[model samples]
Target: MRVHVHPDRCIGAGLCVMSAPAVFDQNDDSGLVVLLDDSPAGADADHARKIAEHICPSKAIRITGG
Candidate 1:
């Protein structure tokens, strides 16, 4: 799977980081969503990424090529 994040659209909600820390993070200064892994490996990571995508309030996370 491929994951993409739009930091400009992020609201710093941290749901992505909370749900998928392996694939997402927050900037220390901006508290915005940070893309840790564009293509996370393994099933567990993929599942967590999907959850993050679903819960993102600003729809900043996008997944493709699954």
Candidate 2:
């Protein structure tokens, strides 16, 4: 699946990072969401990405072509 995070809408809640560290991260200075892996592979990564997208308070995470 393809995952994307909107930096402008991120609230720095860290839910995405906590859910999927391999796929998501935060900026050190701004603490906004960062896209570590836009196209994550495997079932586990896909599940984690879905969790991160669901838990994002600002809905900053988006998944496409899943």
Candidate 3:
């Protein structure tokens, strides 16, 4: 699967990063969504996407190509 986050829609809540530290992170200063893996490997992809969708307050993270 391919995951993408719209930076413009991001609120810098840090929820996505908190939900999946291994898959998501934030910019130190800007605190914006930072995708750790655009094309995640194995089962981590689903998990990452799930957490991203759930944690994102703005719902900026989008998962495609399942």
Clash count (model 2, backbone only)? 0
- What lDDT does model 1 reach? 0.85
Candidate 1 residue lDDT tens string, 1-66? 789889999999999888888888899999998887888888646665658889999999888875
lDDT of 3 by residue, 9-58 (tens): 99999888877676788899899988888888766776777776777889
**On a 0 to 100 scale, what is the lDDT of residue 59 in model 1?**
94
lDDT by residue (9-55, candidate 2, tens digit) is: 99999988888888888899999998888888886476656588888
Q: What TM-score goes with each of the models?
A: 0.89, 0.89, 0.84
User: Mind sharing the TM-score for model 2?
Assistant: 0.89
Report lDDT (Cα) of residue 31, candidate 2.
Answer: 97
How many Å off is the CA of 56 in candidate 1? 0.2
lDDT of the candidates, in the order given: 0.85, 0.84, 0.82
Query: lDDT (0-100) at residue 60 of candidate 2?
Result: 94
- Candidate 1 vs 3: which has more lDDT: 1
